[model samples]
Target: MFPKTHLTIAAGATVLVAATVLMSPSSNVEAKRMSYALDLEQGSVSAPAKGPASADEQNSGEVKTDTASSSAPTSGEKGQTEATVAAAPSEPALDWQAFEIKSGDTLSSLFKAAGFNDGIMLSVIHGEGDADKLQRLYAGETIRFASDDQGKLAAVELQRNRLKSLKVSRTDDGFKGQILTREPEARPMFASGVIDDSLYASARAAGLNDKLTMELTDIFGWDVDFVYDVRKGDRFEVVYQDLYLDGKKLGTGKILSARFINRGDERLALLYTDDAGNSDYFTPDGKSMRKAILRTPIDARVSSPFNLQRRHPVLGVVRPHEGTDYAAAPGTPIKAAGSGRVISAGRKGGYGRAVVLQHGDGITTLYAHMSRIARGMKAGSRVKQGQTIGYVGSSGLATGPHLHYEYRVNGRPVNSRTVKLPDAKPVPSSEMAQFRKVADQRLAQFNVFEGREQQLAMAEEE
Candidate 1:
C-alpha cells in the first residue's frame, strides 16, 4: 500500500528545510536583528551581534521572539499600538538628594545648592496648584529633590511638617503641585489632679502639661476664681485626646470633658458639637460654660477696692472710690469685661486713656489709666468679651502702673470682684438630646479615671 516515490519526496523536502535553517544565522543572531529593529523604532542605540552566542543567549532569543510575536498588532491592537507610540517615554531612574532648610536658605539659594538652574526653580514655583506653599517654607523644614541622568529636575518634595508635605512633579505640560496630608490617630486620655499648692503644680504632678492646665482653668473660669477660690483639697478630672502618628505620640488634642470641684462645689463641663458644627463646653444640664462677662479684666493683684468713701491718693481729698484698681506691669493687656460696643475711647480728667464699653441689660464697663488704647478701638467699635482693649500704665493721675476697672448697672457703680456674671445661652432644645448623650459618655470616662486614682491613693494609704 506504500507509494515509495511520494514518501521519498516528502522526506527530501523536510531535509531541505532543515538544511536551510541550519545554513541561516543562529537563533541569537536572528533575535539580535529583530531587537535592533525594535530599538530603531524606539530611538534607542543597539549593538551588532558579533559572534556565536551561548545557551543563555539562545534561550533569551527564544523569549524575545515569543514576546515580539505576542506583541504583533491584531485588528483590535492597532489603535493601542498607536496610542503607545504617542505616549511619553518612561522616566529614567532618578538620583534623590535631601537638604535641610537653613536660616538663610531662600528658594533660589536652595535650588542653586542642589545643582539646579533658575529656570527649574521658577517653573516649580509657578506650577499648576498650591505653588504658594513654597513661599511659606520655614527654616527647620526639609526639601528633597530628584533629578534624571541629564540633571533635569524630575520631582521635588517639601516637607512642611510631620503630617504635611508639598510635592511638585514634572509633567508633559509643566510642573504640577499637590499638597499631601497624613491624618493623625486620636487616642483618648484621662488625667486627674488634686490641688496641693497650685493648679499648675498639681496638674504637672498628674502628668498634664501647662497647656492642659491653662485649658482647665479656662473651662471653669466662669464659676471658679483660680487665684482665690482654689483650696488645698480641690480636685479636677479631665477626659481629653492624645494625637499619635505612626505609633509615636504627637501632642494633646481637645478636652472632651472635665470636672472641677472647688470648695466642695462640683462643676462638670462637656464638649459638644451641634448640627451646625459649632462646638463649645456645656454642663450635663445643657448650660454653657461661658458667661456673659469675665470675672476679672486682667490677671493682677488688686491694689485698691471699691469703697463708698475714701481719700484719693493724688487729690488728697475725701472721694468715693467707685472702681477697683489692679496693679500690673506697665504694658499688661487689659481685656474687655463683656461683649459690647465701645461707647467712649478718650482721655478723661483723672482717668486718662479711658475706654468704656456698654453691654446689654443696662451694664457698662470702664477701663482707665491705659498706656495706649488698642488700635481701632473707637466709639461704636464692636468688641468681644476678653478682647484686649488697652494696656496698663500710669497715664492718669495715678501713683503707679495699674488698671482702673469699673462695673456699673443702671449708672450705679458696683464691686467688680463681688458682682455675679450672667451665664451664656444654653444649648438649643433641638440638640439637647444629642448633647446629653455625649455628656454622659464623657462623664463616665472622667469618673473611671477618678475611681482609678482613688483606688491608687487608698492603696498607698494602706
Candidate 2:
C-alpha cells in the first residue's frame, strides 16, 4: 500500500479504538464483546482489518448487489406494511422449504433428515446461545432455514421478532471462518392504547407486553412516572420497529413514536432525524432521551442492602433480615424496577403487607411496608416498570413505613437494583448505515400509520 494509504488506514484505526472507549453501554448489548487491538505504537491497524474479510464490510454499506435483496423503507412514505419478497418466479429451482417442528425433532435430527448432514446444527445452536435464544423456540415456533445461490447455508431465520433473526455465511474459511452478516429488516410502526385499569392490562389488551410497557415508561421516566403519575384513565401509544428476516418475524426493535396521556393532557413523541439521517425517539418537538445518567442507581437510595443479618432495632436481637429496606413514607407507591408480573400481593411475616414480583430468569423482588395495595392489584396481574402496586405503610415489623426490597438471581438474594445488568444494543458501527437506512424508512411509514388512524377516527365521528 502507498504511504498515504497507510496513513489513511492508521487514522481509521484510531477512530475505531476511540469509539470502543466511548461507546455507551446502554446503546448496544454487544459492545462489551468488542475488544480493540489497535497497535498505536506503530500507528498500524490490526491484521483483521487488513484482511479481505473485515468487520468494516457491512458497516461501510458494502452489501453484495446479489439477488438476495433486503426490504427497505422508501423515503417520504407516510404509512408502510411488512413488505416481503421471497424467491420470485421459478428460475433457479431454489428449494425454499418451510419446516414445522414435530414432537421428536431436534435441530440436529432435522438437518440430518433434510440431507445436509447435521454438521452445522451444533455450531448453529451454540451460536444462537441455544434454541431458546433462537426466538424462545419451544415446541412450536418455526424457522425457515435456507440456502443461497451457492447452495451453502444462506441463513437460519426465525418466523418472528421474538428473538433475533440470526444468519451466518462465509466469504472464505481458511484458517479462520470468514463470515458475512446481513441484518434483517427492522421496520417502525405506530401503536397506541388507553389504560382503564392497569398498564400491563392495557398493554396486553393492545397486543403488547409488560416488557414493552416498562420500556415505554423507561424511555419517558425522566419526566412521567409509572406510579403516582399514572391516572385512572391514562392512555399511551408508541412507534417501534418489528425486526424481521426474509419476511419472517424476529422481534420488536426500538420505539420510534409514542403518546402518553395523563389526565387529559397528551404527550406526543416522534423519532427525529439527525444530521446523518439516523433516527432516534424524540418528542414531537424534538428532544433526545439520551440522559447523562440513569435517574436512580439500581434502586432508590437506602432502598435495599445485601446483608443477611442485622441488629433488629425494635426486637433488639441479631436476626436474618434476608432483604434490604428502602426508607419511604406510607402510601408511597412502589414500581417495578423492570418489566415483570405480580406473583404475590399480600402479607408476609415481620415484613408486614408485602408484594412480590416474579421477573423472568428466576429473578424476583419483595416490596413491603404497604399501607394498602393499589386498587385492582392482585396476584397473576402484570405490572409495568415503575407502576404502583401499593403504598408504603408501617404494616409489618417496622418502626416506620418503608419498602423492603430484595433481588434474587437463580434462588439467591442478589441486590435487585445493583445487579450489573447484561447489555445488548443498537446496530454496531459495522452495521449502523444499513440499520439507519431501514430505521429512516420505518419512521416515515409510522407517520402515515398514525395519519390513517386519525382519518379512521374522524370517519367514525369520534
Candidate 3:
C-alpha cells in the first residue's frame, strides 16, 4: 500500500497537461515540463485520493512515500510508460497451539477450550490406535491443537511424558493416531553412606531415593535383621543405573551391586541375569543371597518372643504363647516369609483375620491379627516370598496393633526367631561360571568406588 498506485497516474497526468499547453500559444511548456519533473523528483506535488487515509498515515499526519513510483516515466517519453509489479512470496502459516493440562480438566473441556465442539473431540477420541488415551489426560501434561485454514481441527498431539507421546491427525474418513517414544540412556552410578542414626537418613544424604533405599533393604533382608541388627556405624555401598535423555536425568533403573556392613559382618549382593532371563542376586561364591524364609516379615521390633510358659497379657493367665509378636504401626504390611500356598485365610478363635501358608517339608507359617488381608490373598492362592499377605492389626483377643507370626514344623509351633533358616538353591552348575565372572566384575567396581571414597576422606582430613 505504501507503493501508491496513484503516484504513477499523477506523473502521467502532469506530462499530458504539459503537452496540451505546448500545442497552445504558450511556447514555455517545455520549461514547465522540466519544472514539473523536478518537482516530482523532490516529491513536492501532493497526490489526492478519495479513500480514507490509513491509520498509520492519519496518526502521523504524513503522506506515505513510494520511492519506486517517484521516478516513474512521463507520458511524453516514447509512446507510454508501464510498470511491471513482481509478486511477493508467501510465508508458511503456523497452525498448532499448545495448552498445558491442569487438574480437573477433561478431554471434552480441553477440546472446547481449543475451539472445537464435542463432535470433533469424539472423532479424535475414537481414532485408531492409542487415540483413546486422550481420555486419560493427567495434570502437568501437555496437549497441542492444529487447525486448518477454516479453523477446523486438523490434528491433536498429547505429550504424556518426556519419553512418550501420542499424535492424532485428521484424515478424509476419520482421524488417524500414532504413538511416539524415545529411549533413555542408562549410565552406572555409585553411592556410599555411613549410618549416623537411621538407614533412610543416611541413604538420602548419599543421594539415594526412597525406592533404591527400600530395594537395598530387601536385597540384604534375609541375612541381616534390619529391625534390630542395624547399628549407628553400619555402612552401605551401591552401584546402580541412572537413566537420562539428551543429557537430562529421567530416573533410576536397577541396582547392579550392593554391599552392606552390619554388626562387623560384610554381606555382598551382586545382580546377575542368566541366558534364560532369570535374574537374582548372588554372593561372590555363587551362593544365592535368598533364604528359605525371611528373618522377619515386618519392619518392626519384636514385642513378644515365642514362649511355652509365658502368661497371656489378654487372658490374664499362664497360657502357652507359641507365636512371636511383632509390634508395628496400624496398617503396616506383613510380608510372606517364603513362597507358599495359602491353606487357610480367615478368622481363628484367638487370632483374628489370620492367614496360614503351606510350604514344603511340612513347614507352615501363620500370620495373625491383621487390619485386613491384602487383595487376591485367599485360601489356595500361591504367594511368592516377601509378598504382602496382610496388614498389622489387633484383630480378636489382643491389646494393640501387632502381628502374631508363627513358624510351625509338622504342626508343632517353633520359635520364629533363633530357628536356622534353610538356604535357597544356589546358582545352577551350568551358569556358575558365567555368574562368577559377572560377580567379580561388579565387585571390582564396588572396590574401585570404595577406594576413591577413602582417598577423598583422607585428603579432607589432612
What TM-score goes with each of the models?
Answer: 0.78, 0.37, 0.73
Query: How much does candidate 2 score in TM-score?
Result: 0.37
Residue 64 CA displacement from its true place in model 1, Å: 22
Between prediction 2 and prediction 3, which has the larger TM-score?
3
Error of 1 at 436 (Å): 1.9
Name the candidate that leads on lDDT. Answer: 1
Better of 1 and 3 by TM-score: 1
Ranking by lDDT: 1, 3, 2
Q: Tell me the lDDT of candidate 2.
A: 0.61
Clashes of 2: 21
Give the TM-score (vs. native) of candidate 3: 0.73
lDDT of prediction 1: 0.86
In order, candidate lDDTs are: 0.86, 0.61, 0.85
Query: What tens-digit string does per-residue lDDT give for candidate 2 at 1-462?
Result: 579989999999898777645542332333324333554323555434233434675366343434432323244331333222222322233345467766766766666655556556655554533233542454665656666567656446554434434433222441112223558797765666778778778888877766677778776665565654677788887777777877888677677667788888776555555556675555433345533222231234564365667778779988767776777756666766555778888888887887877776676777777888887668888876567777778887888877777666677876543455432223345645654575566556766887887898899995
What tens digits encode model 1's per-residue C-alpha lDDT throughout 88-175? Answer: 3444567889999989889988888899988889998998998657767788999989887788898889998999999898999898
Candidate 3: regions farther than 4 A off? 1-94, 148-152, 171-173, 276-278, 375-377
Q: Write down the worst ten-residue block by lDDT for model 3.
A: 83-92
- After superposition, candidate 1 runs with Cα above 4 Å error: 1-93, 458-462
